[model samples]
Target chain A: MEAWVRKLVTGCLLTLPVAASAVAASEQAVRVAVIGNSPPMSYVDESGKLTGFNVEMAHALCATMKIRCNLLPTSLDKVVDAVSAGEMDFAVVSLLATPERRKKVLFSKPYYRSLSIWLSKPSIKPGSPRTTVAVVNGSVQAQHAENQGWKTKRVTNHREISTSLVAGDADATVVPMLTAVSLMEKPSLQALGLESTVLSDPLISGDVCISIHPGRPELREQIDAALDEIKRDGRFDRINSQFLPFRLL
Target chain B: MFTTSRTPDNYRHKLGAGVLLCRLTAVFSIVFASAAAWLAVDQHALLENMEDLQSRTLPNSMEHQRLARNLEVLRLEGERVLAADNPENRRQALFIVTLMAGHPSLLANEKARNLAIETEIFLTRAAQGSRIDENIRDEWTRISRHLSLTADDISVDGINLAREDVRQMNGLVEQTRQKLHGAVALVLGFLALLLLLIRRMILRPLQQIDHALSDLRQPGSAVTLPNYSLRELASVREAIVQLHGLMQEHESTRDDLQKLAATDVLTSLNNRRHFMFLAESELTRAQRYGRPISIGLADLDHFKHINDIHGHAAGDLALKAFADIIRSTLRHSDIAGRYGGEEFAFVFPETTPQEAVALAERLRAHLDAWVIPLKNGGHIRLTTSIGIADASAQALEDALRLADEALYQAKASGRNRTIQAKTTQLPLPLGGHTDNSGHSA
Candidate 1:
């Protein structure tokens, strides 16, 4: 009788979390990829944890859908690649659905877009052949500048590109205007008396959408439906208000 | 055979078409070139717009979302600054707020940028003082909320702008496509016109000329040259006609000149040079065929004395009368010519020396009986001296010398008589007065 009781206790202990997991799985399960280095979207904070607009938005969406969301933090490019490879269920990172990328991954409806702005030292002219521009490596800005035949200095991040511009390694840089604004407030920039001006009339631009692996048709439908629901129910607005100055869909 | 030494006219215009068609072609070429260049420029502009959409405007819209996030982060950071219990946490929050405040997208919006600056200033002051009292927190809270709202407005404005950009780009693409289609149609139309012009105005005329030239080349061809419609081609046809006319005129003139060169203008008979040429050819024929040939020398009797008595006009009339008599008396195959001022020579092909003497005697008798009525209404009687010799192959010169000696003998014996040279080696006859002229009184 004692042996049976002990066996029953162990069985119960094992079945409890399993039953909880099963229940959770039956409700909904999603692995969401978020960029770890991109600020204002998703970034690793001082605590070395994924936290940003996209990360928070993902959590909010999971809460609304009554599902379990596993957030995967990685580089922007890897996040998209991983989601397309089915290593993650879907990516919440700001990824563009260009025709080339669409061949590899299925994309959700566009959630956001960006405008390109020119950043130059006060004295340098925008788009001059003699002027060297710094662009973020692996960014649309880099491709745009290269296509224009502009002399380019490549850097790993937007801040580094701005820093190259401020350090006189580049005469100008092309970045998202919002990212440039954040770099402008750098203490090092202030100390060096380095200033940058945003040139008017944007050069090139892109839009962002959630990407999914090609085989996940049910998940894609669920996401699309959930997104539609949030948008209709004002939950999306609420989430957007927490991060964006306006609603994004 | 036909002959000419003519050269084609020097032409200044290089084009095959006439001046008017050339001018039209020039105008059309300019129009086509201008249109093509315009199309190229328009295509380049469309490409530039596409580049702008891809690199600048679309990216701007996407970054606008980031801008909204940054502004939200800033507002949250401000809130955190207000909620911080410790100075270090408050300082970190303030730092982030300051960074977001200077953001480029925020700076682009006046209201949002101003509010952000205000919030940054407030946070900086609060952080320095190491205190965020209740009233100060409330002020920070109000500013943050306003900033968030303003930023939201900016985000929505940016999205609208991006959509507008897309709409304009679509319209531009359509406009460009339509323009390109029109340009292609225009170019094709012009090309077709050029081809038709070549066939009608240039090629057809050329083909006609080609056919006319080929017909002209055929033996005994009488085909007329075709006319042309194009001015230049018409001019070419006119030139060819004029050249043909000139060639005909030249041929007629050449015939006249040749006749004048070989004939005696006064008597319409072969001159001394032509007579000698005929005699040489006869001599050659006699040698080759072993045929007998006879030659004779004749002279008008007392021709110089008559000239001295009757005046030069009467002398000329008498000489012309003698030449007419000689022409009437000679056989069709026989050759006669004025040897010099008053001397005549004859070549009777296939006739013996006896037959030639008989002909000479007949000629002398006819001249002796002839009478010329002068302009003065007086009759003048005339007579001739004749000598005949048998000419064999390769002995024409010797024959001629013998005949001349015999004629001198006859003139000495008495004029108006015929004499025959017996042989080429015979001495001159002696029973006559010496008269240097081959004539008698």
Candidate 2:
């Protein structure tokens, strides 16, 4: 009877190795949710397909790091909410990695930089006391304007702020450099003037970065590693060249 | 007997057509002005678009050319670095090489460093020989090859970017030109259409209306006109028709007013002033032709009783009925009218004083027999007293005084009765020759 029990235990141990190997080989395919929406950042196309510069970059990084990335199409506000709630693994939207947002989520190294431009009515000059700045709601830009002792009117979206400047409701608006550049080229923008002064203070410096859920140390390490690899292999330059023409870079 | 005429209505219709033409011409001018404004705006937009395109593309083209020249210079400097000699020259070469490597066109730092090292080694080997050595020459050849490759990469990248920029600028310019051309065409087409519409809808109608109006201004103008195509213009034509009708009514009213001036409004009889004028003319004709003329004055007896018994409306009815009785009693040649409130003067041509007295009696009897119905369910009976006079040079004033006195006598003798005074004896005095005791005969 003792020999029978010893045989059973050996058999159990032998089977455990096969089961463990199967579990290890399967590797529990991790489902990582990446926030995507803004152009040249993360957006879904009319075909319900995920695309854009940040989305493509994220996909490339995920493939290089051997991770399964699921793009979550969401607005910039929702992206911040999802990352904070740990519902998403990370965000690839063009969100400025400000000190305020840094408190809620861990920000990777800045992959892109954009200037803060002053958009003014063509009849008005920047820095004039009469000029009023408009910024999107819940944006760091509004906070930066407030810090600079500049009065700001918060708008619901980028389009509303641009239209407010065009229609002469606001004398000026503050926007990301690329959007300002694109708007300046429009014929309707003849009624607006772009300030040459770039807001490069750290308070206003908009560095677009990937935001990760806090305490996801393992995932953060993997993403950092992949980002470093992408930079080293010149893939970052390739991605930037593809998207730079669409921006002020 | 009465005769009808057509001159008044025809004159009125002509006046109406003239007014309509003026109104139509004003509407045409307003529409033409509006179209001109739209064309002006469209033309301005076209010119602005062209100006915007020129301003956007020209500077970009110039900037691309400057960048292309800078890239060419950098390429030449890279070639010169491979051709230098000596260790010191090579060290100098490295510094220049570093400068070239720092250019944005250089792809990667490693690639730039590798090219810099290879070029420096080639320069070092080349310096060992006074004449060209094969090994050094081969290294020089390799360095040239690398330099060529680098130049190609730089030129390709620069040219591709420049080409893309130029293509975009060209596309914008072409689009602007096309848009300008389209705008100009649209403005011209709009102008043409405006002119056509002005001519078809406005000017032509106005010309037709002008001709019609001018014809209307002339005597005996025709009322017919060509049908206006547009509804608003047609309504104007209809208004002209209605105006013609109104003008006809106005002319008829004027003629009626002329007639009314000679007739008394209350009794539809000749007024006193008009009656006297006609009587004088007839008296002159009678004197010239030696024909007999007679004049009579008739006054109602106790006429104030009619007004006191009933209201003014009943009084008016009584007066109208009395006048009607006298009118029916007179011959067509005899003229009768309300001389003053209750008094009437009549002039009869070719009649004696006795004949005038007989006519007066007939009028008095007719008025006495006539009874007028009142709105108050009562009837009014009236009577007139008469005085007859011959239409002679010195007796006309005496006749009117006698009739007035006779009316007073009829009232005093008895109410509701008529009396007559002869043409002689200066008929009873104004108050029956008033006595101190108010006696009556």
Candidate 3:
């Protein structure tokens, strides 16, 4: 009876480890939510189908890493909230990687970049020191203006910033380079004496990236590896082609 | 206590009938005049309200169109700025922003001030260098986000507030229109109802009373008019009852006075003097108004022979029936009266010489066809000779003499026929004889 018991105990020990391995394998399928809203980046269609540049890039990255992916359709503001709350694994909103936002969530390498421009009243001389500079509150451009020792004021909205420059409340203000280019083409801005100068040390540069939950090092490493593979295989170029004319940095 | 005299009772009945007829006629005229005046006032008010609505709508529509045009101009300017390429383009954009801010309604909001600051930052970056910096681009994004938020707020909240204001204005306009229409309808409705009541209670009843009085004037008429419901109409009825009584009491006295005056007592027809007075008055009216005047004279073929053959009573009956026929043939505007024993006269004002001839011929034919019933159960055939004369504005004596000559000619030519005499130099009637009686000119 003692010899038979010893053999049975050895068989039980091997079977127990096999069952545990099966449970761990099932649990290894990671579930992640990516929040975004920009067209050709991430958007939900009339059919409730999610699509766009961010969606395609996320999928490509997920396939490389062999991980399950999910897209959460939300406004740009909600993207930051979702990522911070851990309700989402990450977000792909075209958010500028600013110092303030970095305090709350980790950002990946910038996937896109854009330049800052100086907008001003046409009546004010281009290089005048008295020209008032306007920037959005809590934005990277505001920090840049503050660092340059330029006369800066905080504004609530971009439209108001434009209006303030026209109204003589501010002689100049900061905005995206593309937006400034678009504004210059309009006849109304000409009649209002509006002009713009693109800054060499850009007032701000917008870099779109995925925002992860704070301190998720293992997941971060996995996403980084997947992104590196996507970049290497020329998938990023294919994704960017879908969003041409709006160049991705 | 109930000892009533037959004479006084008969007098009272006649007086009551006469007084009631007079009062009813007076009340009918008054009510008709009041209704006409009220209708005139209501028509005027309706015209004034229509004018008011037209004036108010025109100016308001013009103002709304002007504001819409201004908004279009501003939108077009905004488009141009978005397309141009230099630092000046940013200034243009800023100018449009400021223009929008200056609008009183937009300036009241805190969001407008925030948008102004964002605009200045955009301008500053554009002026700094040829290429836009990264920091400025992020600032532009934040400004764009805030602008979109404020635009959404304005659309969802501000537009709703404006919609409420527009709705209230519309409600006020509708209410004013309704009130004006209601007032006009009420005034017109009251006038129509009052006219209906007046016709029923006053005019119709007055006409009935007049018919009753005419019946009482006949030898034996037992017709009695129905009493009116209203107090004023009842008072009129009472007055007619008093007048009827007075007429009964004065009948004999009036007969005695008629024998001395110019009226025939038996037939109660106007006598020679009264006929002459009426003819003169009609001639004067014709001359004043420039209308034609005519006269007709009729005489029995053999009045003395009838008095001798049929006796005096038979002669009297024949004269009475002939007088009744003459009165029936004459119109209400024409004057018919006894000239002498068996002769009658008529004054037809506003009648041409041709019309007078036709009327005289009709009278003669009617007399020839008459069958006068005698007391002895037999009917007598009667014939009369008639004469007619007309003048526009000449001497009355000449007209009378001409008519008398026509009568003599009729008798000479063989009785029971009519002859007409025409005067020279009569005025021609206006509007050349176009038979426009049924057709409008």
Candidate 4:
């Protein structure tokens, strides 16, 4: 009975977006969620400003579309829910589109492709269920690790995967090779005999597209068109060259 | 005899059927094998691209994405740590921070790890305070925020890697398609060339053989068979030519064999069967025209003694000598034969008993004077006994019997003598023409 009441309340909260839509014509700022966790694409700088490829691209797109942009910092697990519940318009989450997520949101055109990676000591093999992987909580790595039948040491932050590996809470850590570049360059990793390998798989790695609210199908088209415009203008390439050693688009 | 050469022009290195087949097989194999090998290489390259995607880039991108989300969660937890005043908030924040800071990248790093450590220490000490210190909270925020940024960088890199994999796959597919097209073209070309080779090597030569056959079939048609480019065709033509030569030779040999069949091989005389045929014709003519004809039989005397002394070779020499003497004494119209071993018969057409007796005496005189040289450094003289009979009214067999009886009488009277049979009208079998074709021996 309590569950039914909560469901009713949540359902009503979902309809609140219709009222918001009524005021949307008055140039109401588009609320955009940014996970701000991925770097070079979306992350906070040392200046405590959300500045990365994704952040800059969003600003560029908003400026071109002549729309006022309101940025929202959201976690990866909550970004989908926040946007789905009409609390946000869209999210700049960098994960590739998956069939499961497609059921909830419309995905913008792919901004870039990505690779998954494994970090482990040379003497230790990283596969098999016996091996525990340090994965971020509520992330694809967690799902992938569990799907492999391998135990995962779930962490709250990207840094925790490395910390978990050092603490021997996990036999290895799985992340993108780019994010772990600094960790891999550390002399201590060498002292620890840890090496990183890029894990290439179609199922887990591919184009990273922006996820849009399903209620805003037009927003997905607009974003996709804007993405094409930025690429044509060389803005996407310029940002990619500045941050990465390889092309993303 | 068949004339052969060590390197017959017929069996030269003309385009042989076996060589043509081998070349065809070789060309076909090369085309198909190269095609198969190319396909295998293309498939292998594509498989490599797929393996790379499966094993490395995909897994890495997936992991980084998870880590990126986790870092934001960590930052949210950090804010929670600062905002909450209750012991529950502090306790949860401390547990999360404590677990995260345990990783080597967090603790071992100089800048980020130190802040994470200070935050952990401050949170652990928060039991003494009501809320997290504002200054420590700021530092914790920076630490988590910076870690979040690192997660974003990793995701970008993963995305780039995945893009590279797809690009490589697209290129491989294009290359394979182009190579496949080339292979297809090569196969079609080989088939066309094979058709051409069949015309030059197989089909054309067969038509030549057909023409050669037509030429051979027509009589008086000049047979002009040229050497073929293909060895099998040339060989067939050569066999046909040789067969033609053999046929011509066989025709002439048949005529020679017919003549040899009626003539004696050793004495070169009309053999007994042929001699009787001519004698019978002569008797029929004499009987019909009321003309005279005589039959005579002769034998070499002391012939067994000569064989015992000088072997069958000497006896043969004696018979041949007797035949030569008869051949010399008789006219072309007369017929003579070695009737048996050391024995002979003669038919003198248009001759009476006296005329035959004269001819027989001449033959006797020649035999009496003839000498045969022996291989054993010796010499031998031969003589023969003869008898004549008038056969103007008698059948061939009766006449031959009368002459044989008179020949026996001459042998009894003395060897090497001639005698005449009394003109006998003795009754005998009429129209007696029983064939006596056999070796008189």
Q: State every prediction's TM-score relative to the real structure.
A: 0.40, 0.32, 0.27, 0.33
TM-score of 4: 0.33
1 or 3, which is superior by lDDT?
A: 1
Candidate 4's residue-wise lDDT over A108-197, tens digit each?
988766656677765556685467788876566667787778877888666566667777787787775455543554444535556445
lDDT of 2 by residue, B219-286 (tens): 44455666665655665665555555555566668879876887888788888877777777877788
Chain A vs. true chain A, TM-score per model, equals: 0.76, 0.72, 0.56, 0.81
lDDT, candidate 4, at A205 = 69
lDDT tens per residue, model 3, A1-249:
998998899889979999998778766544345433334445566898787667788778778878666555655445666677777777665567776788888887766565666667665544578767877655456777788777886775455565676666777777655445445554655566555454656336656567787767577777776765565456766676564322232
Off by over 4 Å in 4: A1-249, B1-9, B104-150, B218-226, B240-441
- Candidate 1 per-residue C-alpha lDDT over B252-349 given as tens digits, one digit per residue, 9 for 90 to 100: 68989988988887777789998888998998899789998989998887888888988999988988898899989888999998888888889989
Off by over 4 Å in 3: A1-82, A95-101, A121-138, A145-173, A177-194, A200-203, A206-208, A246-249, B1-441
- RMSD in Å for all candidates: 23.4, 28.4, 33.9, 23.2
Candidate 2 wrongly placed segments (more than 4 Å) = A1-37, A43-50, A123-127, A185-187, A190-196, A246-249, B1-441
Prediction 1: B-chain TM-score: 0.51
For all candidates, state DockQ relative to the true structure: 0.02, 0.01, 0.07, 0.02
